[model samples]
Target: MTTEPPETGLVVRYSFLWPREHDRGEIEGRKDRPVCLVVPVDVGQGAVVVFPITTQEPLPGRSAVAVPDTERRRLKLPGDRPCWIMLDEANSDVMPGSYHLVPLETHPLRYAYGRFSPAFMRVVLRTMGESIRARQLRMVPRER
Candidate 1:
């Protein structure tokens, strides 16, 4: 399938393969999960930047911005599932599958999935930048 540059803050579903063990660099993520596309459009190579959404809570002292349930409701996500957007390691660059946008009842869906509020996207980016500056993220060097 052909790929296009998805706008930032689109809640797209992707099968993320991330490091489960930093020391081992064991990658995981078999099932498709929701992620926010954070990369600006018309950037570099085909690799897209994204933040994976998860039900797991953030570790203490980590930069994980918990998506408010109100926002989740606005996005038409199940209210029962509390999720955290890992600002620390949630940041990733990968080739994406054909993404499906999650629809919202409160807001208009952008592309195939739903869109995140510009304000919220700003907060995410700012928090991620802070995390990077603080050196809070575990580095897994990729082969160029």
Candidate 2:
């Protein structure tokens, strides 16, 4: 028996939030601290993906995880900090919710299951961005 490879260009929505001052102590000294945010997409909605920007290689196979635009503006992520925007086509049953930071160093192999090329990932990001923009336009209230 053989398993099919994951699909490419699956559009998944994700949101990321940083920890408050109170929570800083919990992740002291850790750079890529686990963050919790919302994923609007549902299982089988399309595919799971992430947009991670870090100094290290991205964890494989994991779904797309987006870095909050606010964080990007404030921190100005360094280039050496390898940024990853992952997507997972499997496990669509899980609802969009929050996830804690699970150190990549801990489960190197498991996280590095699926990999995507820079060009391919760029295409995916562009497609998703267009879709999001369209959706936002539709929601805008028309002025008479």
Candidate 3:
């Protein structure tokens, strides 16, 4: 893990266990993927939440925000195939202690890929807030 703590909006690689997968008895994510930190800092005592970013298009009834071309380029994400930040669910972990957070293979010492732009982050936060209020958001905790 990096000595520096992660900040809000930082995109980090993580083994994110989806809610459905967890319900099916999976203990870990099948693979590591880029995930965006949603909470500004620790929630409650030390838990932090992050939303997964995916190249797969959001399906019907799912909540997501497309990453604009400019933002994708700025973040150096792969391809032009389109990406979306999934907002319907998130992973919760014990920040500063979770073993799930990982560095990119290309950048061993760094745990972050990049941060989302403030304006775009605002849109994500707003949508996530709505989801939370509507009881549509699911959280999967990664702490043992």
Best-fitting candidate, measured by TM-score?
3
**lDDT of model 2, residue 1:** 10
Q: Estimate, for each residue in 34-85, the C-alpha lDDT of model 1 and write its tens digit.
A: 7777764565554456677888887799788888887777876534788988
Encode model 3's per-residue lDDT on 2-42: one tens digit a residue.
Answer: 54465678888889989999999998999798898865442
Clashing pairs in 1: 101-113, 102-113
Please rank every candidate by lDDT, starting with the best.
3, 1, 2
User: Could you tell me how far off, in angstroms, the CA of residue 123 lies in candidate 1 after the best superposition?
Assistant: 1.1
Provide the lDDT at 130 for model 3.
84
Best by lDDT: 3
Task: Give residue 63's error in model 2 in angstroms.
Answer: 16
Give model 2's clash tally: 23
> Which regions of candidate 1 are displaced past 4 Å?
1-4, 21-28, 40-46, 94-112, 138-144
In angstroms, give how far residue 28 of model 1 lies from its true place: 5.1
Ranking by TM-score: 3, 1, 2
